[model samples]
Target: MPSVLEIRWIMRPASLLVVVAAACVGEPDSSPWSVADSAGVRVVEIAVEPVALPVYASVGELEFTVGSIDGTDGPAFGDVGEVRSLPGGDVLVTESRSQTVGVYDRSGRTLARMGGRGDGPGEFRFLHVAGVAGDTLWIWDPIPQRLTPLSRSGRVWPVVTFEHELADRPGDLRRLADGGFVARTRFQPLDPLDPKYAESKVWTDSLVLRRLDAEGLEIDTIAIAAAEQLLREIWPSPTGEGDGRPVGAMLPFGTQAHWAIDSIGNSVVVDGTSGQMVLRDVRGSIRTVVRFASPPRPLPEAEVERLRRSRLDDVESSPFRPMVERVFSKELLPTAFPRVGGLLVGESGTIWVAQYATFPEEVTEWTAFAPDGEPLGRLSLPARFQAREFGEAYVLGAHTDEFGVQRVQRYRLERP
Candidate 1:
């Protein structure tokens, strides 16, 4: 395993970062778990047994909620991007509709509001509260392609800009342990002149995750994983004046790659086909592989049909609704559910993997693994609650009411 060791230079005028490869100290385990050394790298393989019981039945104590539909307190968020709990009882929320970040107390009272709809240094076009580093919060704006630092007291710091190529619609922005960041460049534009572009229904490619320093400079290129397959159909323009436009969404029930950044700045990738997870360091070296023994469950046809109908209803108001309807069908759905749905790494370095759920009425199962790859058992929560951040004692999530009003909710993490 390679460990980072900072050493000051005696003769040189500047400091240099060095990585030292350490020798493996532990012995290999038998059958279910094993450790091996390959090409100067330590690899730990864990074969996890199927967990039968959940650690918690419901983790909902409802510590606090901040939002409303009546617009009574100006906290009526239109499209909430992210939520993070502060050091005290304050909660930071990002609303893309207003391009604002609102800080609220535990009682849902607004403490401070920052940013607005503009392209200025402090303003935002598509604002998202990415993560917090010490007393500063990092805000991601993909439209103008920049990361703006905001203080807890609503102070705006110097903005960090990115190159146009690197900032063109990146995926998730994860904060590193050393105050850096990693952004995943998800898609590659299709060539319009290519014959395959007109004939292909599903396009598959690789996604590149780039690592940037705290100053927003590209420092290293991280791992490349399979991108989500696009399910699209070519539709002629409504005006019938130009080339056909490709209208589609990510393929439902398709096997793709899901990843999360650990507390120590390592990247963990897992393909949805199975319960295998690959852990790599910042230099993109495979350090470990965690695999669960359970196989994928068979997906019911009725459930697939239900999901298709739900997706069609979501795009009912779109102009490409007809093309989307043609793209979503039972035949296009996978026969078995993806073993891994999503991945989340807690602030304590504990890894949580969520099970795939097709509907809100279903129960979402999350299995936690230690930093060393030991299974910590599973937990269950309502599918309606979308968890944004998970800590040892609490989970911050977004809950939508029956009237479609968004609310930031903090729930106590209850375990047996």
Candidate 2:
């Protein structure tokens, strides 16, 4: 077994910025852990076990401020997409609205502003914050299909073109351990009944994850997509339509996608969106699979309605409210709750799988798993905060105020 020192540097310079974590001391347990409740799924035995309670209150409260909002020369996020912890207790955030990336310290002071929106060298036409590779920050702009490296000192490295010859559009782009990249492609939806969808260019789909080398060439297949078919519109509508839906009504809901890459670039993918969590290593092979012992039952009709109503209450005002009502129709909610709503890979190789809340106002539950595929404990987050990145003790996520102002917040978790 590799020593903790080796595992700590699995991704090396690329991962050094994510977190300068303490090495996990000890060898991995090779014995398989089985569960009758998991439909006979195979597991692995690890020395670690659950040491905490079932719920972690105040975690979602966003009261513990490890990082704050900066509006000066730093970052005032109009639309926050991703947040990541840096080496020196700093954090990196991607603001999609303004097409910029900023680095902030624990006190919320701006360490550096990487780049702004533009078509020039440092200017980003399609801003995509990939990951930290030592002093180089990898950003991919899929529109121009280029991977541009931003130096730690704010210089633009030579652009690496992504000659994406795939049949599907790519979604999640994770820079891998060997300087390669792993991407999620969109799956093509079936024939569209609406004329507007006849040529939907930006709808999201992917039944499999693809890996590319450092040069942006296809290397291997990470994991196969779920068997389930879900059509999610990607592009936003002009005015009346929300999320590419028609002005008055919406199309069928798509499957919620949740996956996380560990410090080494190995991914934890939620299979079937419910039954299984597949752990694929850097070699594009399934190292061990993690299954939930007692999975929650699908949401019942009443619960589904309650969820829908909860959303309706959130709309402060809508000029298209009347139009939305006239044609507003929806397919039945998925029988089960979202298989997996969110995923976070801890710096220590632990996994946090977040389940969807019936409503945004309710608490969110997360199943924790050890590095060796052992199901640790579960925690219930007190409220809604869309977590973008996490560390040993804090969750840095995007939170919208009651007034609809977006802010990047850091919520510290107290196990007690």
Candidate 3:
């Protein structure tokens, strides 16, 4: 395991002014309406209108399959991070653990595996995600705080390093038209003793989103709370405690910021725990868009009673016990936030979002929207392929683990 100390030492400093500038340009607004269940979890319903058309099956919808490639002769991939569609139907996949890059064809064949684990010009120790801008592949290594450009042929370009303090883990990277990029940084409260330790923080706080430049410079930083209020109309309390606590007192615990950036550098930061999505434009106008109704499940009252009697000694045995206790002990239940599985912005300003019926499931349903964020239609993906984007076609990726063996597969989106 990589130590937190090492991660901090490798941190790079980037321009924070860019992020501030970006956040300043957006119009701050709240969601139009909100609804809540008996459990006190707010739910917002987005009015979706479906498009009428004879849906045709996309190319290679079921035409592709997963295959194994030898990593000994090429770059090895440990844990796959983000995968993106290249211009010529190719794909770029990030391997975090191994600190390498995997290039595959549309058919899932490994064309070339490049990049290595090092701090040198063409090397990387950890990378979060990558995006393609024109002919260059931009890889974002959050730990090192740098964005290194690579050629399609697996050659590394000059390194662009930035000086900035990024939270422990960084989010996805999106390519912009002006030859720059925007990425999100997630912040967690550092444990006084162990600064990087993360425990039961998910239920009570919101995360911060910092926009970075192409060189890993900080361009702007936006509180998830402000974004949530403007886009989802849901204002999350910063204090983990609900009543009497000042607003924006405590940051989001566990995982709070979930977002994706489009080709235009616009970002959609979704707070699944809060049922809000912060839509940020290039000019820094922020809109809180809320859609998705909380599920009908009531608070697990019986579980609450059981927890009260459970011994503190028993709780120490399981780390999850405290989280469960916190929720039930406080008369809270598991809330449902609309899962934005994948986001894609087309060349024509069309936005496609893959929605999950449940959390962490491979099967996905997709919705299309115009540039103005109007809903267009919905489509379901095939069982095996995990849907990412839906537009003139669909893009899907899948990871399988059977009998301890792991493999990844990609397929074209098809509509029927």
Best candidate, TM-score: 1
| Candidate 1 C-alpha lDDT tens digits along 155-268 | 999987655355336655767768778887754656544556665377665667778777667777777778676765566667997787766567777767888875346777
Against the true structure, what is each candidate's TM-score? Answer: 0.80, 0.70, 0.61
TM-score computed on alpha carbons, candidate 1: 0.80
Q: Please state the error at residue 8 of candidate 2 in Å.
A: 9.3
lDDT of 3 by residue, 302-368 (tens): 5435434553445677644444345443423343323454556544445566553333445455565
**lDDT of the structure predicted as candidate 3:** 0.50
lDDT of every predicted structure (CA atoms):
0.70, 0.59, 0.50
Q: How are the candidates ranked when ordered by lDDT, highest leading?
A: 1, 2, 3
Q: Is candidate 2 or candidate 3 better by lDDT?
A: 2
Q: Candidate 2 lDDT, tens digit per residue, 1-416?
A: 66322364353344322221222223222322332223444454323222232333236345423333455534466777777776766677777777787877766667677767878777676677777878788887777666788876667888877665764556557786567777776556444445556442223344667777776677677777644333322235567454454222331223545676754567777753454677677766676666544444566677655645644555548654443332223443355655465677877676777756654434366766655455545765545457666565776776666755566677777654
Runs in model 2 deviating more than 4 A are 1-41, 44-75, 187-204, 227-254, 293-331, 358-363, 411-416
Q: Arrange candidates, best TM-score first.
A: 1, 2, 3
Candidate 3 weakest lDDT stretch, 10 residues: 245-254
